[model samples]
Target chain A: MSEKILIKGNEAIAEAAIAAGCRHFFGYPITPQSELAAYLARRMPKVGGVYLQAESEVAAINMVYGAAAAGVRCMTSSSSPGISLKSEGLSYLAGCDLPAVLINVQRGGPGLGGIQPSQADYFQATRGGGHGDYHIIVLAPGGVQEMYSYTRDAFDLADKHRMTVMVLTDGILGQMMEATATENGEQTADNRQEKPWAVGGVRGERARNIVNSLYLKPSELEATNLSRYEKYKQVEETEQKYDSYLLDDAEIVVAAYGASSRIAKNAIDEARSKGVKAGLLRPITLWPFPKKAFAAAAKKARAFVSVEMSMGQMIEDIELSIRCSRPVTLCNRVGGMVPDPAMICEAILNANKEATA
Target chain B: METRILIAGFGGQGILFMGKYLAYIGMSQDRQVSWLPSYGPEMRGGTAQCGVILSDTAIGSPLVEEPDILAAMNLPSFHAFEKSVKPGGTLYYDSAFVAAPGTRSDITYIAVSATQTAESNNLKGLANMVMAGALLKSLPGADGGVIETAMKKTVPERKREMFDANMKAVTLGRAL
Candidate 1:
């Protein structure tokens, strides 16, 4: 702890990005996540980093493409709709095997969705939104602190693996008030390691590093994807994190992520007061899915309830994880809605009652 | 036992900060606590609310529909969530902003002109903290001393002036 103060989640992420040595930022404004873009726009000029609000999401991603080709630490962010426009650029980034950070402060969407928070884009993020057999390091942050930590990690991991990394967050995590002033986040604006690959005047010192993904052979593309997948598996193995609350003697466990899990924790508290042995499993990494934790918890948990903002995206992961536990149940609110704790408590009570019966 | 609460008001009223203060004190007291809010455009000078739960057991949900208590700072919030308060639950409101804070006979409603009192104290921003002190007066198991300490935890060390004002506001608001 450096100095304690309260800061919104988006501003924290921006400060973290700057501390991580990412000097170039390109983005289009979108709701729920606009605070990040705005923060970058205001600060980047003072720090001598390039901050451009591109004409559209497409243009922002393309600018990222150009910067990353030069091997510079660069980034761009958008909401779900803007993320859709950048899909083509994402595929291009994957094909080229370049490193950059992309942020999706997801809002409800299949199309121009409302500006409230939702996790419907989980499929889009984990599966790689564009048409390709490629992969990107996907990180999910549930709160304000991770909003800062993950952005820094995304940059480090992207550079280390020489691949793209996306920070997947919801509107709440992007916009919520959180205590981050104690953390030394001012470093985000000042840290940038030298990248020989970045585009700048070479001054006859060495050959220019050309960035391209135009190899015509299918085998070449397949090899690139395989290498990327291998890197992803390593990330999953070492980088996965989830939080457990009062599960030691719990008979029923509820699984939720991001902002939804916090609500679930409240429900568990309520249910336990009423004599229901409920607990919560909060996944910090949505892509890795924390299958092992779910498997371990299933040893004592009679049943697991998979809760999310979207109906069933993470439910698929939960169902595949536990072998002997009661069938997983779902509690959700879609189209920019958050699930209520009362409903969660009811589900836990009902599930516990059914198990007893 | 679970103590789930919802605190709601306009943006400047410090409702969110009140929730944060409760959470901090709950944490210091070794209770399970979480603070959650309705963010984004709704956070812009309009009705802002936070759902907080302080429990002795593992927390299952963070959402507080039919919260055990409500701290409604303004009219819109009272109207939006009044029906959700549990029977026998306590409601603390600033009579200055909320003219008719729900007429439910089952719930205990404490109306205080907190904003007016805070303005009179020459600490308008303290209106939120004033109402917060009123909550300490009304709610069971809530202590004024503990809440004062909690307010210190919330105030940034750099904003020491804000602390005296907030404490004074709390005292002034409590008298109402």
Candidate 2:
């Protein structure tokens, strides 16, 4: 057994990115996510990597764009407000087919919300926060260990699909500390500078690559979008990940993701102790939504409760996933408040009562 | 066994550090542990608190809504969190500043003059360590020696003197 070390979620994510060969990090500091930038700032120098604190979120995301265009495994992180500023850059990265990782340690709000943990950005994350019809792969982790593992996978998935990937988290998970094993983490950075599409001189062997997002011609733009859709479909087929607990004979299924899923586990355990056949279906990949898992569980589940730290945001996707075969209920706490386990247990019991009635 | 703890105090009273130390000890034991702090603008001078959960199995939630242990450092903290302790749980508080800790027969209550002990030992900032010691003494599974070792690693080299004082405070509080 490898020795486990205690690490904060933000720091773990940064280290995982470093272990995944992501060297160049361009991000502005924001509450909840500032620790990530700080960790990279301290570790990047020792590892002979670049860690630039851009002047603004706008500039930081654009810097990531420039680095990604050169085919470097670069990333940027921010909270809700800062992520809003980077929407344009994210769209541009998607359009250009540049593989870049973005992290949103979410805080509350549509405007400048408070600096507390929140999952209110669920719709924004899955439904495309940026303009245009582009989709970014979003992975939500329930704990600190997954925070590290999923970040490493986010880099791999982004590069594999040549798309933008996001690790959607909340302020609480970003600040929480937990024990995580570093067994699977790479020991050295692999910044290989060999991409056929990268905009760098070919050393007289081939034509210079021109990486761009602009398509003035309508037909060319349509073709580029169609090709991007094909890649998105491939990702949907292969990249969906989820975890289920006590779901085999579950009469009530509690659907949640990220930190909310952590709470739902406790509720499920409590409900089972009281003879309630409750289960938890946690969507690890938020973008793909794990529709099949829900569809399978819905066959036995009499009702579904979509638990979140937001006011019914991800519940929409949950309903769509199950095709509303069973009644879908929402149990949530918004504005940076976390859901209580007892409240969720109560929701499960209520759903069971409704099923019997 | 799972031990869920909630430590509450003023912003400068090292509540977050207290929880972190407990989590560090749990990690040293190779146990599944989590430490979550209450953050934001309220942390400047208002109340501060953190939750720490240690379990032999994988932890479900990092957030502790109903804690098995409550360590309060001040009057406001004591008043704010006394009722949140689970039935048959433990509540340890510093009696040096808090006069009334309220009555609750369902839970075990321990009032240690942690601040007085630290001040008497010329360790004004070691009250949190004293509480840790008291907590170690009251809990069934935790080891004081493991916590001491964890404390040594948590304290930086520049704060070597502070570590000695903290250890002294812990020893003093353990007797209570």
Candidate 3:
């Protein structure tokens, strides 16, 4: 246990990456998430790690792929437009079965959008941003502490699943500051699993390991994709992480993630005070989607409200998760705008009215 | 108990720093605190603001929409956030810089010439601290001694020489 320090969420993620033994960081500076790369640039060298500001987002993610293939924990971070450029590298990393961490401190976007907090990158992140039959483990951190702990655990998750682990956050969570204890007693490099398949020098000990994503043969590619899907299936079953608040007997369930979840929680509290049975189900892992929790809550929930910073992107997931058993409504603000608690509370109240009507 | 504070001013007016200092003081007292800045392409002289929340329970949203305490350091900030203060909340403004009168009677309006006090006390560029001192005095359960301890941690190590001047500015504001 270490003393709590008031730190920015971006800096907390950077510090946690170092604590998790991530030695390589390759990133291009982008708004909202620039502090993360800047922090690493200052601290990486002091901790005997490598921090390289690549010429472009493309180069940065490729650099991450290079480091991860060499059996080192490495990462890259960017905003919405920057993440689009790195999508190619993300697919390559997935195809190669490389372990790495990536961060998307998202801003509004289709291209070159405004630099404010947004959850518009939900589809780009959760549905495999690039071309391939693949999925990255997406961890959406709601607060500064989760920003720290999740980044640390992201390294382990990447290694365990042999895939990219993304800490999908928004500009608000990245820029906000909160009291967090950076040092947890359990984080050390010694706890990391050995990467025997890493393409480091074999020293003439057994066969050399090869790292490549190329499989031209149709049969081989199909087999590889099948095996990867099996891994993803297992992850969906075992790694679904979420936080439930007053959900046991609630008739209105609000499904949210990342920064929007914080707003949803506040709205739920207000709704409860108004005699509405509104609860919050915040998904910590966006890719896994916490389907079980949603399905269970749907049994008692009459309606589900998805509060998001995007134009109802996560609403599809809520509908799919519950198998459309309950009516799902969308309450959203987009283009760098965030919804206040009142707006979400109004939506919850509307859902309550609709359910009874 | 919870206090949602919104501090707004020009970028170079130490708006973000004042919010951070308050957040540090809250943390020192073992209160749950969160500070969020309104970040964008705005540079120095452009509008810069931050929200600080100090609470006893878990904080849901860090953004302060309807602030319980609104501290406006400049005219633009005062005009922008004056109406957003909760009813029965407190609005602290630097009357020297913001030259605005309160229109609402529901909220308490306290005017302090923090800018003039800082300039006279040779604490230029530290009017934010002065306003913060006034806020500390008004905040419930905030220990007066905690400000100095938090200042020790809040002020960067490279700028240790400015500690006394900052304290002096805060004291002048408190006395006023």
| CAPRI classification of candidate 3 | high
Instruction: Kindly list the per-residue Cα lDDT of model 3 for residues B107-156, writing each as its tens digit.
Output: 99999889988888788899999898888976766666787878877886
DockQ of each: 0.35, 0.81, 0.89
Could you give the candidate ranking by lDDT, starting with the highest? Answer: 3, 2, 1
Per-residue lDDT tens digits for candidate 3, residues A1-357, read 488888999999999998898879997898999999999999889878899989999999999988998999899999999999999999999999999999999998878999999999999999989998999999999899999999999999999999999999999999999999887423555356789989977899879999998999999999999999999999999999999888988999999998899889899999999999999999999999999999999999999999999887889999999999999999999999999999999999999999999
Q: What is the lDDT of residue B6 in candidate 2?
A: 95
| lDDT per residue (tens digit) for residues A1-357 in model 2 | 145677889998998898888889997999989999999998888767899989999999999999999888999999999999999999999889999999999998869988888999888889778888889999999888889989988888888888889999999889999887664334654644456788765798988888888899999999999999998898888888999888898999999998888889999999999999999999999998898888888888899999988889888888888887899899998888888899999999999899989
**Which pairs, if any, clash in model 2?**
none
How does each model score on lDDT? 0.79, 0.87, 0.90
Lowest-sum lDDT 10-residue window in model 1 chain A: A181-190
lDDT string for model 1 (B63-104, tens) is 577788898888888888888899999888878877764779
Model 2 gets an lDDT of 0.87
Stretches of candidate 2 off by over 4 Å are A183-186, A189-194, A203-205, B156-162
On TM-score, the leading prediction is 3
